[model samples]
Target: MKKTTETLRGNYFFKQDELIYVNRNDENFVGPFHDHDFLEIAYIVEGEGFHHIGESVQKVRKGELFYLPIGISHVFRPKSTSGQKLVVINCLFSPNLLPKLIAFASEKPTVDFLWRMRDGLLSNYSVRDRNDRFERLFQSMFEQYSTRAPGCEDMLHALLFQLMVELHRSMRESENTDQSLPKEAAFQDLLHYLRNNCEQELTLSHLAHLSGFSERHLQRLFHQHTGQSWFKYWQSVRVRRSSELLLRTSDKIQHIAEAVGYKDIHSFNAVFKRLTGLTPSQYRKRE
Candidate 1:
């Protein structure tokens, strides 16, 4: 049986309040050339097929993720009608959210990806999800779209952000050295540095110098990934490290405070109590 590939516009597909559509589909054969008014991310879940995008036809297997920007006509054709079934998960979202995506994206590749779409410069491209990480995230968005729970819209948007960032990371890992994002290396390195070096009195100015970002930009970067301000993130890291010391080591509370970068016991006790709702000594007692 032949399949139809005439996808209707946004109004025909999306629901009210929740404007995204997600479905796991089976493709039987090649369909007519069709374009969409919205953006799409298609994850091939099972079987093999060929994707006809723009002027290219690429052999696509399971774990291949494709990006289809608006107005890009494309179709999927299964390799054979009698072979293993071709399963795909298609996620369609409105173009209205692209502005927000461009605004909140902290890295270059992501902004580059969205800009390519905005300027009509993007050709459809596919990436391989070697780790099955994308499969899990796609499943999550599928479930969230299905359930439509409280804050479902916000959750799906957040998950979409996660998916894009993951796509960027996978791209970086797959790129040759010359094709990499040079100075704007993923903010992941700086995040790890902060988590690993909580003992130092790390300042925003210092971190900004290291990351080649303005102090304000670095603060926004911190909030983007850690959901906390610079001072709060550093404080939380310090407090959490102190908790581990409190539980694992025989160090005195005053020494633990100093070890985690606090100059005095009083300040450490204040932050620890506020964060844990227990004084350091009381927390130790509970354990």
Candidate 2:
């Protein structure tokens, strides 16, 4: 079948020799499913909606931020039943900005993570707009775009980079907060983290780092508590999440699989069947 996706051109959106573009829109006006030639940072300003990205139509509400890579097909549709229309602030730029960021930034972990973001080492990410500071920063970028003041292009570029640094800071602070668990957390705290973040890419090595446990120790703990290896335990968590999505939403099988962190639909099918003794399709039909 021919693809129905619309393609957005960078030249059309980024004018005046600008490195960044900023816009705010009421997403209630549903638009064509489209991919673009540049990176995009879209933040929900208010209200609620569904974001159609990849194969998922995930419900999103106010304070959500998404970093979309080039060629990622997506669109926003405001909730039909909501009193308030969904609003979003979008910041767009080419992935080519990475080199400049690298040249200007210090060798900090935050900077390193931003590189991963542009390099596709990390998957698309979304977070709550809990930081008022970021909202103000985004608003400043919008104003800078509309005013076209002297040096506005440079100003917009700086503001965009500032947002990236602040994002890493906020998220790191959040992680530190999560890590405040007592050391004697006895894998309980780490287990809870795995359950809550099953959608994330957490490997045994990473989990060991998070818990200050040796990888071998983590293996033993998993076997003791769950009668499974570390990978098997996490797999069960993801499969359980997949089952919940299957029963609770009308999303496609592929969408459900991705939502649970399975990139390959075939792998998802095999695992779901192995654990539940029913294919995802059959499981859904049984309910």
Top TM-score prediction, candidate number:
2
lDDT of 1 by residue, 1-287 (tens): 33344765887788774467888888876457788888889999999988887676889999999988887778877888777777899988886776677887887879987676666675566887744678989999889888979987888888887887887676666564763354345466676677778778788888988778898988887787789998998899889999999999888998999888989788899999999999999988898
Model 1 CA RMSD to the hidden true structure, in angstroms: 10.5
Tens digits of per-residue lDDT for model 2, 1-287:
43379999989987766667889998855488899988898988888889988787899988788878788899998888556789899999977776677666876886788788777776577776542556778899999999989998778777887888877765665567565334434476677788778668888899988888999988988998889999999999999998999999999999999888889999999999999999999999999
TM-score of candidate 2 against the unseen true structure: 0.57
The segments of candidate 2 whose C-alpha lies over 4 angstroms from its true place after superposition are: 1-3, 81-83, 170-287
Residue runs of model 1 more than 4 Å from their true location after superposition? 1-7, 107-109, 172-287
